[model samples]
Target chain A: EAGVAQSPRYKIIEKRQSVAFWCNPISGHATLYWYQQILGQGPKLLIQFQNNGVVDDSQLPKDRFSAERLKGVDSTLKIQPAKLEDSAVYLCASSLNFHGYTFGSGTRLTVV
Target chain B: ELKVEQNPLFLSMQEGKNYTIYCNYSTTSDRLYWYRQDPGKSLESLFVLLSNGAVKQEGRLMASLDTKARLSTLHITAAVHDLSATYFCAVDDSGAGSYQLTFGKGTKLSVIP
Candidate 1:
């Protein structure tokens, strides 16, 4: 089976600039998640979508980070006015139901 | 809030040796997962333990879960250089009314020749 697909493999942006990352989940997976992994740390959940409708996003910084999974297939995460601390790897994952998550290669963002 | 902790944040072991990584969570959850990640790469699922006392093994790695104690473990048997990677244990919090994973800081493993 094809793995989750992510774009831009890498990105560099200046502080206060805007950037977006895209992800295409595995075929037929109903749940998609976005996680932020800082250097030498675990991946933290940023947002979750269950077939287009948001399931959880309590950890997302609404003021700067926003994500949407339109049509319940592909997802896009955008960070506006990016901060230096926002420089991290953004990972996208999908599950058939609630388990067996498969993660994408991730987008490495370097905020200058 | 849920917290997951892994011991020995970093581990350096000689090849042909054995070691175990521990993961402890602050809350109750029956689902535990282990994932391996190489530098500059995505995570690869290694194991999924669903119930207390569940144990699963693949290749040179084995994982066990004890939900009663809110703990999980990944054991490396006869470690090899190819096993060098970051290992993470994540707990499913759906039982807590949220469908998300709470991950541990991860253990950076380096296998020395």
Candidate 2:
């Protein structure tokens, strides 16, 4: 089975600039998640979507970060006015259920 | 809020030695997941443990869960250099309405030859 796919494997942006990352989940996957992982730290949930509708986004930095999954398929995460602290790897994962999460390779963002 | 804690934070062992990493969580959950991540790579699922006393082994790595104690252990037997990577334990928080996972800080393993 094809795994979740993410692109732009790497990106560099200046502070206060805007950037977007794309994610294409596996076929038939119903749940998608976005996570932020900093250097030497665990992945932190940024948002979650269940078939094009948001399920949870309590931890998202709404002022600068926003995510959406349209048509219940591919999803996109955008960061506006990026900050230096936003430098980290953004991972996208998809799942059919709670137990089978398949993750993408992630996009490494370096904000200077 | 569900909190997951992994002990030792970092572990360095010599090849052919054995060691165990621990994970403790603060809430009740129906499943636990173990994932391995190599440097600059995505997370790879290792095991999914459900229910009390569930144990699963693959190759030289074994994982056990104790739901009654809210704990899980990943034991490495005769560790090899290939097994040197960061390991994370995530607990499923069903009450969170979406089966969201609460992940531990991760245990970084380094196996020396």
Candidate 3:
């Protein structure tokens, strides 16, 4: 009955620094997703995982962004050498077998 | 990548009125999802329409899908101020090798009293 959980509701980092956001999906959920929502824009898919195995990550910037959902339970999204454009709300969502997603209160990243 | 578009990006309406928000997708898909988000908050699942002519309603909000038209509609009946929020419609990327939701630029609705 619990919702998806994300940590560090807000974060601030300097340009070129590194940062990470954590997420814990709901129990028995098989799909996990990470999305980046820039101000006034739609949430863009960064990565998606189906039970620890990556189902899609084509939108992720491999040179800077990386994500992993280990053991099919929790996920973490990392951005290395963060840029000003990387300042956005990182949202984590979970779904049961490709159904509707339940999102977490995203981590707002502010890169200075 | 699938492209989703929602018309009337911003709407300001008076309470007790009626309105509809439209969502259009670029591809053919059978399932469409609608979500509502409040200011500084997470998305809340509103309706998951799985087929053509599928309609679901809760309280004053109603959603319908037309697979052939690649469109969905969110109709607000007797609108209330509590319905003020951003509404987004999404569809799964049916392209090869990817499975993620493609979201539309949301429709921010404000119901004035």
lDDT of each: 0.94, 0.94, 0.91
lDDT of 1 by residue, B1-113 (tens): 88999997999999999999999999888999999999999898899999999999999999999988888999999999999999999999886465688899999999999
Model 1 has a clash total of: 0
Candidate 2 stretches greater than 4 Å from native: none
- Across residues A1-112, which tens digit of lDDT does each residue of candidate 1 receive? 9999999899999999999999999999999999999999999999999999998998999999999999999999999989999999999999997868999999999999
What does chain B score (TM) in every candidate? 0.97, 0.98, 0.96
Worst 10 residues of 1 chain A by lDDT: A93-102
For candidate 3, lDDT tens digit of each residue in A29-106?
Answer: 998999999988789998889899988787899999988888999999999989999999999999896757889999
Candidate 3's TM-score reads 0.96
Supply the TM-score for candidate 2: 0.99
Encode model 3's per-residue lDDT on B1-113: one tens digit a residue. 47899998999999999999999998888889999999989888899988899999999999999989899999999999999999999997656644578899999999999
Each prediction's total of clashing residue pairs, residues at least 3 apart in sequence or on different chains, is: 0, 0, 0
Which DockQ-derived CAPRI band holds candidate 3? medium
Please report how far candidate 1 places residue B71 from its true position, in Å: 1.1
Clashing pairs in 1: none
